[model samples]
Target: MRLRLKGARVVDPGSIDDYKDIIIFDGMIEAVIDPSSPYPPVMLDSSDPSSVTKGLKSEENDTNYSEAGKIGVDNFPVEEGDTNYSEKGKVEASPTVSGEGYTNCSKEADITEIDLAGMVVVPGLIDMHVHLREPGQEYKETIETGLKAAARGGFTAVCPMPNTNPVNDNAQITAFMVNRAKSLGGTRLYPVGAITRGLKGENLAEYGDMKQAGIVAITDDGRPVENARVMRRAMEYARGLGIPVISHAEDLSLAGDGSMNEGIVATRLGIKGIPNAAESTVVMRDIALAELTGARLHIAHVSCEESVDAIRQGKKRGVNVTAETAPHYFTITDEAVAEYDTNAKMNPPLRTEQDRLAVIEGLSDGTLDIIATDHAPHSLLEKDVEFDRAAFGIVGLETALGLSLQLVNNGSLTFDELIEKMSKKPAALLNINNDIVPGNPADLTIIDPDAFWSVNPETFFSKGRNTPFAGYHLRGEVYMTMVQGTIAYHRTDGGQ
Candidate 1:
């Protein structure tokens, strides 16, 4: 099948940024064509509905295409006098060849064309951190539900943590996850294997076996590897296998059963608090380990000013360390917990206003490499409890982009930088290619930058509805997401 996505602004970070047409064939991008090139003629059969050009517009409209069979660039009838000429936008009656921006499709071939006049096309977003509770904890989320939510959120791929009930510690569990996601068929899933067996922080898992079974990275996500020696061995082993060791950087003793950030908010509420040192101290240790072992280390969900500075300084010393932070860390502060809102609670809990600013600065200055959603889903049984007893996370996959777009809106990062952090950088880290180039998989996201919508958890595709941003208005929406040349999700109501 041949698909021509016409007249959309193609924003593929450093590669391309212009109004162009994308040609997709058989689940791959066949070509990126400049709309200004007039070599390929618009071929259309007025009698055939499917062959009619889509996105028709008057000459007053600057857009070059039309909706399904009217006068437009891809398919317009060339009349005798009023507007038809050979040198102009007229197509040859029967040209059977291909040119710079044109392909002559045979009558037997099926061609589907969509006119995306005002949309922006980018590489599909990838979330390096998400929790899809399958294999054991299906009540909270399944592979189907989590993948659907990721697709609707414009993520083409997601890396699920290995914190399932049984934990993905071996080849059997890793293969089960990979096969399940493949069978479901939507957003791609790359499982991150457990670093320590059972996340116990003692015995290291079989990195070679898990990597063979298809784990992209290794991490003891929900539980930190408390033993420095164990973590160092894990990093060294992962380095030999050429996979990054993702760290859940938190000192359990320092965190000490805290429910939220250790600050005035927790103090006033009389709740247990987790101080900044709880996370930064571990982060510093991991960086030192990475430096000593010559291993790639990625710090997950960095939430404080001290951790950001640590990572920045590590990079300065030429340490092989990379880090990520979630949107909630920068968008909101510990103050969101002022009313004892359990939904606002998360591990390495939201920090102070100063910490939030530091995170934004880290991202702007390239200290942080990726913006991943630690999309943990929980049932009401875990979330409806008291503040200190509530679950430590909120469903983030659906709200990540909307919240992260605030950075661009506030001039904290450029549009290109945001796309790089969300799509390009993550793909590079995971060793996947999601660029909008010919021969690459047609995994793309179409966005409506001005589309305004309220954060309604009821409308979310994820099973979990726990969110701190519910009812908050956000701009920039995922208009449609395409994976492997197939439309996985399309926003129905357009915009709220």
Candidate 2:
């Protein structure tokens, strides 16, 4: 099958960022044609209204296609009276032509020209850190539900952590997660194997075997590798196998039984607080280990200013280190827990506004290379409890983009930079190339920059309703998400 997506502002970093017509065939990008390029334009048969506007009805039909776009196996949106070739114009590309058509090349096959005007198309977003509680804890989240949520969140791919019930430490568990996600088929899941066997932090898991079984990286994500010697050895082993070691930068000893950030808010609320040193000290230790072992070390979910400083200093020292900060780190702070809101209670708990500015500055200056969503999903059973007894995460897959867009709205980061952080850079760290170009997989996200929507957990596709952003108004939304040339998720209502 052939498809033509027309009239969209394609914001592909390191490539063309113009109004182009993208020709996709058999799940791969065939060509990206500039609309201004000179080529013969094929005319449509106006006498046949069906040929003029396929699947779209006129005013008399009483079936308005423009009100809310429809997705079918054989039909795409083509509004009546629209002229953006993507809408009303059609170029019948001859299969025999080479470098002589509206596009540089044409396949003499049927093309579904979709009008994507007023939309911004970018490479599919990837979240390098998430928790899909499957293979054991299906009560919290399953692979199917998590993938559906990811697709709806405009993520074409995600890397789940190794903190599941069975702890993805062996090749069997890694293979199980991969196969389960593949069978579900929507968003791509790259499982991360545990660094230590059973996450005991004593013996290193078989990195070579797990890598062979489709594991992309290794980490003891939910818990930090407490033993420095074991962490160093794991980094050394991972470096040899050409895989990254993702560090959950936290010192449990320092963080013992603390519920929130140690600051005025915690003091006011009379709750035990986790000091900033709990995370920063471990971050410094991991960075030193990465430097000594020459491993590609990645710090996960950096929340405090001290940790950001440590990562920045490591980068300045020419260490093989990279870091990611989640939207929560920059969007909200421990003050969100002022009323003891359990949803705001997360591990490496939210920090002060000063730390939030540091994370924003890190992203702005290239010190923080990626924006990942530590999308930990938990049911109400775990979240509907006292502040200190609640689980340590909030569901992020559905809210990451809307929250990250705040950076662009405030000029902290340009739209292109935000897209790169959410899409390109994460893939680079995993040693995967996700550039939007000809011959590459047709994984794309269509976004409506001005669409306004409120955060409603009842409408969320995730099993978890644990989020602090509920009832908050957001100014952007994901209009559609496509994976491998097929629409994985599409907004079918006029919620905007």
Best by lDDT: 1
Question: Model 2, range 1-496, lDDT digits (tens) per residue?
Answer: 8887877889988775777767788888876665332211222455643342332212232222221121111122234553444333323221232222232223443578788888889999999999999978899889999999999899999999988878999999999999998888788999999999888999999999999999899999989999999999999899899999999988998999999999899999999999999999999999999989999999999998999899999999999999999999999999999888999988889999999999999999888999998999898889888999999998999889988887898899999999989998988888777777778889999898888889998888889888999998988889888889989899887863
Per-residue C-alpha lDDT of model 1 across residues 139-177, encoded as one tens digit per residue: 999999999999989999999999997999999999999
Residue 72 shift from truth in candidate 2, angstroms: 33
TM-score of 2: 0.87
Candidate 1: regions farther than 4 A off:
36-105, 108-110
Query: Which residue pairs come into collision in candidate 2?
Result: 95-108
Give lDDT per model, in order: 0.85, 0.83
lDDT of 1 at 328: 95
Models 1 onward score TM values of 0.88, 0.87
Candidate 2, residue 376: the lDDT equals 91
